[model samples]
Target: MGISLQKGQKISLEKEAGGGLTRIVMGLGWDAAKGKSGGMLGGLFGGGGGESIDLDASCLLFDEPGNLVDTVWFRQLRSQDRSIEHTGDNRTGEGEGDDEQIKVDLAAVPANVKSLVFTVNNFTGQDFSKVENAYCRIINGSNNSEIARYDLSCQGSHSAMIMAKVYRHGGEWKMHAIGEVGQGRTAEQLLPQIKPHL
Candidate 1:
């Protein structure tokens, strides 16, 4: 598996009303084109040049083998306090991220925490559908009976940040399809990206 990790970016979770958390591990990976023009705009009207992936608002979770969450497709699981890992990798074609691996220890989370959220936003893209084969899964802390996942790259659009859902699943505290908010074709605005689901 190709995993990438930024020095200061990774998964995160916090709960104020729950018992206590001690360990949190997050895995992140993405496919790189490494050819032709990069995903990020090389020069906006011949202005600035930079990397290919901007990850100031991305997170990870545990899931299956074939399942995947590519780029900006994991917008169905909405976190109350959504985790945002920024790495400044904003291009999609020219270059690649650090190591395709990220790490987060739950034990390191802040105390007195209440609720958590996972949101993927603020990506420079020519289209949203280009961000394909996306998915996410959250592993349970108790008995590990929790399992939640969603398909995030189905819509036809090619350039829209999404808000994934985050709620309990199977009676075992879990995260499910909190629903998507940016990939909708008709929903032209950001509000429509997540409001109708509410």
Candidate 2:
């Protein structure tokens, strides 16, 4: 068990690990909300039931001035500098855990990069109200141990969420849980909503 983060809470990675971390993995998971039966006909025809949600996890690298440097997402599995890599896309949120994952080599990250923002977008255009049990967690890559986790309990009509961010602070790495919901289907479309947090 690791530290469970509340919305807007921040934690130092170095302090949590008891030392500097070389690499880490940000895992995102979610499932579709089970729909109520719409009468006998609905159940017989599978009208009202749980449907698969296609949520995409993305990492956006930003500089000190909040300019986008590069991104790692389903389309682009690897960052331009090669310091970040997305495991792959999981279309159906039907598995047990971590529908999508983005791995980062903290030490290998370019010096000019100051922050890495993690986001989840409902790419299939379904609002988050149709989602359930969504969460974002950080795991130490070295030992596969969870360092911290933030549950995305905000269920609404929004189509996207700015989950959390790992940023440099005072020569050390720290994480902040944003948990902000908005409208966007891709990282590029979410840029405006992301600037306020930067």
Q: What is candidate 1's lDDT per residue for 87-170, written digit by digit as tens?
A: 233334333322221222344322323122344432554343334344333433433322333334443444444434332233
Query: Could you tell me every candidate's TM-score relative to the true structure?
Result: 0.40, 0.94
Candidate 2: deviation at residue 88, Å? 0.5
The residue-by-residue lDDT of candidate 2 on 77-136, one tens digit each, is 999999999999988789797889999999999999999999999998878877889999
Cα deviation at 163, candidate 2, in Å, is: 0.5
Residue runs of model 1 more than 4 Å from their true location after superposition: 1-22, 26-56, 59-90, 93-104, 139-148, 161-173, 183-198
Question: CA lDDT of each candidate?
Answer: 0.33, 0.90
Error of 1 at 132 (Å): 1.9
Task: After the best TM-score superposition of candidate 1, give how far the Cα of residue 11 lies from its true spot, in angstroms.
Answer: 18
Query: Predicted candidate 1: what Cα RMSD to the true structure?
Result: 11.7
- Among the numbered candidates, top TM-score falls to 2
